[model samples]
Target: MKNEIDKKLTDKNIKPTAMRQLVLKVLTEQKTATSLPELELEFEKADKVTLYRTLKTFEENKLIHKIEDGTGSVKYALCQDTCECHPQDLHVHFLCDKCKKTYCLNDIPVPTINLPIDFSLESVNMVVKGVCFNCKK
Candidate 1:
């Protein structure tokens, strides 16, 4: 697992450090998108600054993508290995209202929009809110 983590970081041109590896491990283990506060709780003695930096580094490297699910808190989830963080690579996100957990709906691509002249698409954030299967049960 450690080797796999290291390889992933290195492939993204991010130097594999202790903090980076640990944070990546946590992100990889998550079933839903996670916020900074939620990630801080995972560590016994987390350096807030370091954790923030790690997340920023990951985002910059396209190892993870941020999600704004209208919950006020920005969450992050690991990107697919082939993900380039491009507009076309973006997908719809599912936010479970009952559980308040944001999940990556990877199979569902965001619909294409025909922009007006002179307008260009940069990114799109589409979130579908509903009760997740776990909550429905």
Candidate 2:
């Protein structure tokens, strides 16, 4: 698992430090987007500054993407293998109101919106909030 995490970081042109590997592994294993507070609980011994910097580096390297579900706190999730996370590569995100979890709907591509000629697009964030299947059950 460590080897895999290292490779993933290298693939994104990031040097796989111990902290980066640990943080990435946690995100990958969770199978869902996670917030800083949640991660803090998981890595109680880790310095908040170090963890925050690690997350920032991952985002800068396109190794992960941030999710803003209008929930006040931001979340981060592992990007798809081919995801560059550009506007065209953006996809829909689902936020479960009950569980307060954010899910990346990678299979559902975000529809392209034709903006005015004068407008430019850099990034797009679309989140659909509702009770998830597990919550309904």
- RMSD for all candidates, in order, please: 0.7, 0.8
| Model 2 vs. true fold: TM | 0.97
Regions more than 4 Å wrong, model 2? none
Residue 130 shift from truth in candidate 2, angstroms: 1.2
User: For every model shown, what is its TM-score relative to the native structure?
Assistant: 0.98, 0.97
Residue-wise C-alpha lDDT for candidate 1, range 1-137, written one tens digit per residue: 99999999999999999999999999999999999999989975988999999999999999999999999999999999999988889999999999999999999999998999999898899999999999998
* Model 1 residue 47 lDDT score: 88
Q: Tens digits of per-residue lDDT for model 2 on 19-129?
A: 999999999898679999999998999999999999999999998999989999999999989989888779999999899999999988889989999998888899999
Q: Rate the local accuracy (lDDT) of all candidates.
A: 0.95, 0.92
Candidate 1's C-alpha runs over 4 A off are none
Q: Please tell me which predicted candidate would have the highest lDDT against the true structure.
A: 1
